[model samples]
Target: MCDECNQYFAKKIEKRVLEMPYFRDVRHRNFIESKKRRIPVSKGIIGGAVDLKKRKDFGTEVIVNSPDIFQKILNGEVKHMIIPVNDQPIEDNKLISRFIAKIAIESAAQTFSSKKGWNNFIINTPEFKELRYYARFGDKLDMWNYSQRRIYNETDRFLNPKVSDGPYEVLHEQNLVFLRDRELYFVLVLFGIEYVISITNPKIDGYKSWLIENNNKCPIIEKNERDTIKGERYF
Candidate 1:
């Protein structure tokens, strides 16, 4: 948030961009387009697994299911907050994605033991009920599809894995904090990227509306345009 921090991150990002193999030829063009269009040049998401065992607690992952937690984060009651990233940008570039993920993890560690951390993350009963309803019954139509059901089953396996003959236990209880950490990491990274994009591209219009309307569409690909190439190749 500070000027120094902003400059530091910008420099770090620039350095990473320069080191990338593709940047040698396209560097100048990329820089020009980025500054001109206010679009962040991204490298894409970081691949591979994150080790959550070594990570400091960023509060209970289940707390995200509570909308109030987001409100508290916005209110600054929670010093560490994870912002959800728009899927479009990540799909477009890998460097920005990796940078955002790194920042999220670092931010969590930076504020892990803050006095004003997760103490205000108390669950709201009504909110919990609403979330539960949506998770269970909100998408009945999609639930009937075979592929959707399979995906849901896989998610269930991860979130509530079986233990011997006993009932399934929550993932965190099973010490699968890595899953939670990865989820939080992506959310925070996305938030950071979104914030940077907004600041740099203040003149770009309809960004919010575009996000809403095309949330499910691929940002790197133009649907219904037969001659247009998709993904990073287009650039």
Candidate 2:
């Protein structure tokens, strides 16, 4: 793997082949850097969703490699190759689909709850409906309960119908390419145990110019920048 690509993965992973009788070794392989190229494996299996924030020091998403690729690794048959996504590493890291998926997983887990007492706390609105083709796997469910929300303190703040948080604010521009029109300029808040929100129609044009003028920074204005649209662009 190139140093740049390696910078985005786990600093170390414990890997093993399913068929191997007695081998447990650290896996080393390059990621498919370019989204344009055809993914070589046709029958890959979903591994699991990971929290990049927990592993932020590593500088990349923590998705497990596909099972098909894992099998090849077990047999020592996998090969390394470099596929360029872009010249700028900043954009490349920002554009990663895994990170977006991670956000969706975290959001879904935080907002969707089945607890009877917290029925009033639910935010059932759907965003980015078209990107559902990519589903999460493993024990970490894509939905969450009120109890879990308290555990993570990941809830939206500012819950009112008129005022709203925008999606571009949540996903950021580098992460906005996969979203549907209605999903843009929408926002959700994760505060303490309570998730707060306000419903607003999507506004791509207004936010686009706003983001560009502000260098596509955070959609939410910060306290220091409260007076200026140019304040340190919320991230």
The candidate that achieves the highest lDDT relative to the unseen native structure: 1
For candidate 2, write residues 1-235 as lDDT tens digits. 2464334332211111111111100001112222333211211122222112112133333344567655665576754422212111122121222333334434544444455633333223343332222222211233211111121111122322333542111211112212233433223222221111112221234444444576544443343432212212111
Q: Lowest-scoring 10 consecutive residues by lDDT in candidate 1? A: 145-154
> Could you tell me how far off, in angstroms, the CA of residue 147 lies in candidate 1 after the best superposition?
22
TM-score of 2: 0.25
What TM-score, over all chains together, does every model reach? 0.22, 0.25
Clashes of each: 10, 15
Q: Scored by CA lDDT, what does every candidate get?
A: 0.30, 0.27
- Give Cα distance to truth, residue 168, candidate 1, Å: 52
lDDT for model 2 = 0.27
Worst 10 residues of 2 by lDDT: 18-27
